[model samples]
Target: MLYLSQFIKMLLIVVIMLQWINPAQAADLTVSLSDNQGNPLPNIVVTLTSPATIIEEAEFSPQHPAIMDQIDRQFVPHILVVPKGSYVAFPNSDSIQHHVYSFSKAKPFELKLYSGRPPQPLEFGQAGEVAMGCNIHDWMLGYVYVVDTPYYGKTNARGQLTLTVPPDDYQLILWSPLLDSKDSAVQYSVDVAADSKIDLSLKHALLPAFEGFEQSDEFDDY
Candidate 1:
């Protein structure tokens, strides 16, 4: 009888240990974005940065090159989020030539008229927004958001993004090309001790939507 009692005590201790360790594992942060009308807003860039998570330039490692393809005279993704110091390839899949350039202060360079992929990918060394445009196609516009942290992603069709991050206090930032100049981004202080969800709405109405390639008169010319 004593032996069985001791075995039960050991099992209880082990179970208690597991319950304590489970909370230390990474947790998910579900963020849902909406516009003024409460309609789900997609393509919004979301980033979570902790004050303790300071990244050094020497520790920055570039992941697989990101692709910003030109298809049917429009940027495949209207907005892209990339980590700082990462490379982005501008591949022109269309038959016609494309000159992709960004005047944004983050990374400014011009890819003169070209049909195929550029010889090399351009590196985004700064952390800011890079607005791209095609010299030949005036209405064509796109944005590349460069962030310093890896905990970043764009909202999907459902206007929701899930990020797995260690338990910490983070500053959640949201940005979109459609955001008004006066209110470019929305930010909040989030304390994530476990799986958490946040619902955010834009303070101001978004700017008019960009003209798609199909909607432009230039579509028939090419």
Candidate 2:
């Protein structure tokens, strides 16, 4: 009788874990990216990748948005963050029509020059940064951060990001377009508590980013 009771109790515990517990917790995480010499990096993209063990779900995803403009022959915000597989709409808020395209490795698509809003948002279903350009202007440039993990953020001018996450040991990653190292990814181990701060400094710029080309060859694939 005792053995049977213990077995029943164990089964109940397993059932509760499968049905009641959630695998992922929603935590707020902040991140900062800088050069090898510790200068704040703007327009650098960050992403939280999954460890090899996780097979079912992604680490994170971005919300939906479709905002683009051609004011003064420039792309507003310069850089954007989006979830993999989400859609982004292009609205020509300028008097003249604009042509937009990305030759980045993740996914490349083009919107032929036309005024007003485009019919659909370009859907990117990968976790990487997609460089955007106004094919007409050699000076116009922008970036899209396609993130798969939820714990990510952009740094301010001071290179600061505060992340809220469940208190646990995690692998923290940082990336920038001009990271002194190869891919600009500086990895660290973090134990994030409530409002805990992780301050980091990086080296100097490694490569001279060409103004005209938005190619993935900019970095060595870090």
Candidate 3:
């Protein structure tokens, strides 16, 4: 009985130690973005993709729809990042109606004039940037970046994003609508083990924000 009790205690200790050394513990990856002028660039989408991350698994799994809201004639987020095959709802919170549409090749669709949430969300089946604008309010511009990987985030006001992911080798990708079409996506090879940080600077100055559509009397009737 004494030997059995000792064996049980040893087993308990081993179990506790094993739990402390769990390989599933998530690691933090900090990504910092800056423009060529060394100023923090916010609203940039960052994604991490690895061989272990199955795109099909993420596509099949149901995810809560993301919202691209309009308030005061502008897209609240300006840039939204979502996993490929996810749905995005355009909710108009402003008093005025908004007609949101995207001409980008990734996803091309339009939400006719509406004042509230649409009945259904639109799915972004492809992995690319969707540049959106309001047909009625030409100045209103926004973007949706759809990525194949499930691990993604957007930079905050300070141009910093932290992602918790399993330790593995991954390809880090960054995207922004302001970037030129040819250089929109920047990729880097990263191996994440323990907590790590990466700093990236844009090669060129970002394009100026869309001010407004060319003034024309064609729409003077509203």
Candidate 4:
């Protein structure tokens, strides 16, 4: 009879320990950014940085699971953020030939014009907003916003973004190609809880927009 009682007590302790080691939930956030006029800004980048502690069950991997493509003489998702040391594939998905090139702070590589996947995809081995353009199609311009964090997302036409992030302390950053002036970007600290709702709104950058054909004009001016 004593053995049976001891067994029951041990089982209860094991069950309680299991519950304490449970994983944290992913946080929920609703982010938005715009100009003083409240106009919706496209290509807005939102970043949620976790605290130094392990809020996320998984650490950020060096291998980024993301890709950007060139189609219809345009780069899909004009802006993207990938973890550092990530391999971003730039596959050509259009009928016309494309000559991909980038001159950003991150990786600076180029691909000659080719058709049908061009053997392999261009690997972006660094982190930065590398500006991409096509020599053949001057009007073909795109921007890849390379980021090191894992929890990030871009806003849609509604100027809002929802990204699944591990619960932790984060340095929230708001980025956009457009903003009225010095107020183009802003970063703040936030404590993200699992499934918690967060929101933000900021002005767009007032800088000149990317014009694929602008390169041609620059040469002519010189």
Which candidate leads in TM-score? Answer: 1
lDDT of 2: 0.63
Worst 10 residues of 2 by lDDT: 213-222
lDDT of 1 by residue, 1-222 (tens): 999999999999998999887846788999999888899988888899997765455123335578788887788787878888878877788878888888899999898747754647778889999999988887778888899888888888989999999899999988777787655544689999999999988878999884644375445545
Residue 118 of model 1 has an lDDT of: 61
How far in Å is the alpha carbon of 18 misplaced in model 2? 16
Clash count, one per candidate: 0, 20, 0, 11
What TM value does model 2 have?
Answer: 0.68
Per-residue alpha-carbon lDDT of candidate 3 for residues 28-98, written as tens digits (9 for 90 to 100):
99999998899998887888999898665433323457888887777867788878888887768876777
Ten consecutive residues with minimal summed lDDT in candidate 4? 53-62
TM-score winner between candidates 1 and 2: 1
True-structure RMSD, every candidate: 3.8, 8.3, 4.5, 5.4
Write one digit per residue (lDDT tens) for candidate 2, span 19-109: 6686545455566555556676655555444452122443222344556665666776677676666667676666666678889988787
Between prediction 1 and prediction 4, the one with superior TM-score is: 1
Quantify how close model 1 is to the true structure by its C-alpha RMSD in Å.
3.8
Residue 4 lDDT, candidate 4, scale 0-100: 94
Runs of candidate 2 with Cα error greater than 4 angstroms are: 1-44, 49-64, 181-183, 206-222
- lDDT of each candidate versus the true structure: 0.81, 0.63, 0.80, 0.64
Clashing pairs in 3: none
lDDT per residue, candidate 4, 73-179, as tens digits? 67775675665555566667766677778777686778775667544544555656788877777676777776667777777887778877667778887665554
**Superposition error at 122 for model 4 (Å):** 3.4
Give the per-residue Cα lDDT of candidate 4 at 71.
Answer: 62
Task: Name the better of 2 and 4 by TM-score.
Answer: 4
